[model samples]
Target: MSIVQRFSKIFFYLALFPAVIVLCAWQGWAWWSWATAPPAPKSSTGETSDADKTVQIRIPPGSTSKQIGSYLESAGLIRSSNAWDLWVRWLNTQNKGVFKAGTYELSPTQSLKEIAEQISQGSVVQISFTIPEGRNLKQMAAYFESQGFFPAQDFLAATKQIPRDKFPWLPSGLPHLEGFLYPDTYQIASGGITPKAVIDIMLKRFEQVALPMYQKNPQQIKLNLLQWVTLASIVEKEAVIPAERPRIAGVFTQRLQKGMKLEADPTVEYGLNIQQTVDQPLTFKQVKTPSPYNTYLNRGLPPTPIASPGKASLQATLNPEKTDYLFFVARYDGTHVFSRTLAEHQAAVAAIRKQRVQQNQGAIPQPN
Candidate 1:
């Protein structure tokens, strides 16, 4: 038609073309979203088999999220690194890069989302080990080594490196850390556990449990923290029955109060480097051994604790049983009879010997 009419028509077409393109683009985006959005993951069920991509990923200390994600993918615990990264970012966990260094047991049944959540939340596998009361440091070190916590030599070396000043409770110039490592079951990660870390945790536990007792009755007992621990250690090793601990502690306390030699067999054994039960009765020569730890000569608690003490022994030290008994001997059964006089102690020992003789006769004799 006319020029003005043609120009108006062209402008209208141009504008309409842009609107059509905009509408198409919007529709395309909607279609793409529908196609690409992931399906809601199925809730894990009992039917899931253990064989489904089960892997243990060890995220060592100081590892970054990128490193952790790559490790999971390599271990086949997750399907895609991108998915895991996005899932971790969305969770906004405080454990951002602080994934506790550990050997985590992971399963293939777990989605990338679940795996990421677990890692970020420190859902790592835990290993537990218990140190029984009365165990010496060497025994404790052996137990740790057996549990794969650390090398036994490493534990021993770490004890040497421990600063005496830091632990004022410890006696000076001690050859090794013997009775100080408190005995208790501990939960720790199976990976990245250093010797120092293990020792530090045990020492802290010791302080938490034993320090208060020392503070409460320091002077009344007339023993320093280390001396108290030393006495408690002897009590731990000597008393087989739980009920007898207080009585044994009382005997020691009485001897200490009277300035009499402790003459403890365990102390003599410790001096002689003999930890097991002696086949023969202790002789005067055994008691006369020249060691700083020999209670027979020292006339008090040894330089340090003979072994680590448990709560019962510690309590016995704090509250000794009031008894006139000064000597005790183990009966053939798992018990001990106490006596006050030397004559009474001799009679009890004779009775125990007689019982042992009868027990031997009662048993079936092996072909000799």
Candidate 2:
């Protein structure tokens, strides 16, 4: 080769080498920024509103990394889908993990790496729901429906079809999952959450929280699971004051031991599916009306639990306060007056009614 041609070739090689190095440096900087930087906020007024704060993006099952990236980009949760694809490829090479399928609550302020990691780790959006104590299965359904969780009928239907296969500890021949569902706050995954899933969670909670107490048999109560829950449900409905649970439970226990009718007002209401307001208390006619759940007319516990009892009521039923109290009457206040005999109970009831009448006539309230 000629000297001129060789010199030209050397210069070309040197120039090409520098250009390649600069290109590589630029690419590295771009990738670094893309990985670490969050998407720019789209608020024109320079303030993040509630809508712009967070977005819910669903990653469908069997979605490829590219598809997830595209979704994130469209939702304004990420800067670029191309960058996401490249980052995901790199993650695959490192065997970090696969992105799971679920609804994700993501914010635009989160970096690409943070969002990707969360998805990969299956950190799905969770919705917290609470079941207050003493709520019946029907009431629970209504509440769930009102909260947009599902249809009231769906929840009710799911309760009827108990998944005994998943929960072997569930009592056999359980007509419906009434008292079995634990009453407490629950964190449920946002997407694809069915009524069955919610029921399973609640039953699992019951198994975890309340079942252990029964297994321990601390009180050595002779009642089976059904009966224990039945009595607890009654206690839950009857007790207004938290401190009165044990005493109320004691009254029922004495009634049961003596083979006397419970005649609990709550049982009568449950059977009739009616709540007695202060202005309209349980009438004699209502109490006299016979139903399977009416403790007033029935001899023993109702066929099933009237409502879902909380931990306190369950505990109170298991370990009742030792007392001779066979009867009790509500004073319209949260407190109830306990009596050793029917005469005392009747007197207490009369006194409360008289006091209530006086209060209605603008008279001073008397102490129970």
Candidate 3:
């Protein structure tokens, strides 16, 4: 009964140890699991859209899973704190710095699974706003203000407050955010969507999108990053057709290299400070109105970006197409006609004017 019985008993307990631990874990999860049943159909109010029914809850910085769960329970989003705790441990979203700390939009109507996934991913409630290419910072400020996202004055002020040291991608010596806003559709959390927050996120997004190309070959970018963005901003306004960006970029590059005037129409328009903006066109005299921003009068890129340049325009400036073309004329159909020589450019200009004249003329009908 000694050796054989003892060894058999030891093996039985050892095998049972794992199973017991597994059982304990299962029980612990069950204890923490949300006990609430599915939400009823009519829980939302008539005034609130289904999307608007979510209650805003903030997870304070450095909050533990247990603490987060307690907060959720207090907010009445979950059945109990322990239930939320259990769900967090099960999902492993709160594991080893994976926990996301931010204000979250959650509803009691949502399943524990959905809440866990949402918070783990740090998905916050966001209001979307799009920045169109070639829009200057001032224009952007007014647009955001009109949308009630933030005050235009506050937005402009926040641009100067951004910590340049934190972001290597952003060029220093710029007076304002200007070209770096990186025109794109952005979503921000409803309540905390500050102008500073928008600028921060967009700067990061710009870094993410543009840095790769620069990192590949910094020398390929002929101009400094800030200057390149400035030039790209001008190109953004010039090229309406997406296919023409690289070529338009090429024409600008050629002009720059030859020490010839850029003579870009947008630069002059920007310089004139047109109150109505692009809605109003500049007269011929405004093009000759000398200003630092006016490429027709200036030797190089503007002191800063004239407007926000999109990715296509940015890339175009970074790697301008190799071409001899130095001039371009806008056509009536929102396209450009590129010309390599002065004579050729003059011909294109005359053709464009004739087309516009034809477009403006009213056809005469013979009397019946």
Q: Model-by-model lDDT, in order?
A: 0.76, 0.89, 0.78
Model 3 gets an lDDT of 0.78
lDDT of 1 by residue, 1-368 (tens): 99999999999999899999999999976754433232223346745444554566678778877788788777766656666566566555544444567788877656655565666667778777788999887777888889777789888888877556666766677777777788998877666477777777788888888777677753435676777888899999899999999999999888889888887888888878775442376677877879988987887788777789998998899788887788888775668888898899999989888877777788858788
Candidate closest to the true structure, highest TM-score: 2
- lDDT score for residue 247 of model 2: 89
**What is candidate 2's local distance difference test score?**
0.89
How close is every model to the real structure, measured as TM-score?
0.74, 0.79, 0.67
lDDT of 2 by residue, 1-368 (tens): 99999999999999899999999999999877965578764567877765368888988789988899889999988888988888898999997669998889898888899899999988999989999999999999999999987899998998999788998877788889989889999998876578989998999999999999888967735788889999999999999899999989888888898899998888899889999999999888998998999988889899889999999999999999899999888877788999998899899989999999988977655678
Ranked candidates, highest lDDT first? 2, 3, 1
Indicate whether candidate 2 or candidate 3 has the larger TM-score.
2
